[model samples]
Target: MKINQYIRQAQYKKGFASIILIGVIVLVALGGYFTLKAKQKSSPEQTSTTATDQKVYTISDTNKSTTNQLIAESKIIESLKTNWQSIQALIPFRPGHPGTVAWLSPYSVQFIGKNNLLVGFEDGYNPGVAVLNFNNDQFKILETFKNQAVFTFSDWQSLINKYGNSSYPVSTYTVSLLRNKQIVSFQDLINVPENIFLKNY
Candidate 1:
């Protein structure tokens, strides 16, 4: 009789322990679910709610990355402004399309890589593009494009079609030009398509 009583108590204890184990597992799962929900609620939205959100995020969601890239590029251009004269002097050849050189100026200069620069030359009648490689204060012209047609854009639509809708290079002065023309919400100028150099002249 005593043996039977002890067996029943052992069985009860085992069932009770199993119930406690199940309860603990269920509690842990609920805690984890609530924690995940809390984190999601606290997180910021990936897309802006409206245009009034912020200046940086005012553009379309697809343009956020483009805007960021342009901002960073603007900073680089500003820093390189101090060395404009030295950079311009590195151009070995003058572009002459119709007649005399007239004027040679590097209007839009931006770094395409760590040591490579894509320079846009405004030579009066013949605007051109030049890719220069610089190292240790020395600049070597890799290639040049002296086609006036490539740099001409009638309006914003023509500009987009030419440059694949990417953000264009802009200067402090040109910012107002873009605004006055109402070309785009942001200031920009037609940048030379980088792929032009990939092909043979």
Candidate 2:
């Protein structure tokens, strides 16, 4: 009877050990499956967040660049206006026609080096190009080509191609006055349906 009880106890011990081993294997497998599932679920969310961040950064950079460009353009326009005003003040228009009355056409202003500029203006009467030189904080008329015909876009392009060589830096800005007296850039004028080459002469 003692021997039989000992055998039964040994069999019970072996069964318990098997159960524990099987339980450990099952727990390990479940842990691995859950970890894999969690990683798969988080990956898409992380990718989406990263993409959103990149898009936001790109838009911010573009806005900053656009703002800076607009500021620079405004400064250039102000400088052009100031210089033109100074020139008009120094060289008064003939009697009965003020400088303000003589500047009623599309104008092209080009800033050359060494504080020099070339300005083309068309006023119902006098339409031509003039070279302005800034010296000692004062503006002086270097040369003037008066009574020129109205030049179209093609004409201006032809002139530029004829005169502007690879060696010459011909950076310029053109502006036109609207019927409402509002000044607009030449680039903007091209998009309008109205004819931009309305000759006063």
Candidate 3:
């Protein structure tokens, strides 16, 4: 009878152990599933591509990709232009204090993927693009392009033709292209892609 009792106790312990082991496995699997789900929800594609107060574009060359880049801004046309691609990304502002941007002026800010750009203005206030040039690798703000915001349909049409957008967001924006304060126009601009000059530059 004692032998039987001992056998029964051993069987009970084995069964209990089996139950505990299976429970542990289930708990671990559930934990892993939740952890993986959390990670999947936070990916780079879900991240904002633009810089603070700027539009961010991921431009790729044949062999390389650039990020946070600041390029020269101009009113010229480009055949193969690299813009925000979507005017929805632009943040227009009226001119601010010169210190609004770290390296440039305080009129408008544009994101050149890897670099933050400051756009300057001629009137020291207003939202407009400067046809800029580059001297010794530095951006030089040149001519300013302005539409009357004329409060008229014809005025709207003119801006739409120039900026290539009839529905661009209108606001007081700021950025300053850092270069010779006296320089203006795309003529002196350097590092500009030829395609930008050809079509929608």
TM-score of each: 0.35, 0.37, 0.28
Please write out the lDDT profile of model 1 over residues 114-190, one tens digit for every residue.
45555665656666666565566556667666563233324323333433234443222121112223332212322
Q: Give lDDT tens digits, candidate 2, residues 40-84.
A: 664333455445434433545657654443344335545556666
Overall lDDT per candidate, in order of appearance: 0.50, 0.52, 0.35
Flag clash pairs in model 1: none
Q: Is candidate 2 or candidate 3 better by TM-score?
A: 2
Stretches of model 3 off by over 4 angstroms after superposition: 43-59, 62-65, 68-201
lDDT of 2: 0.52
Say which candidate scores most in lDDT.
Answer: 2
Question: Which candidate has the highest TM-score of all?
Answer: 2
Better of 1 and 3 by TM-score: 1
For model 3, state the Cα shift of residue 128 in Å.
38
What RMSD, rounded to one decimal, does every model reach?
20.4, 24.8, 16.9
When 1 and 3 are scored with lDDT, the better candidate is 1
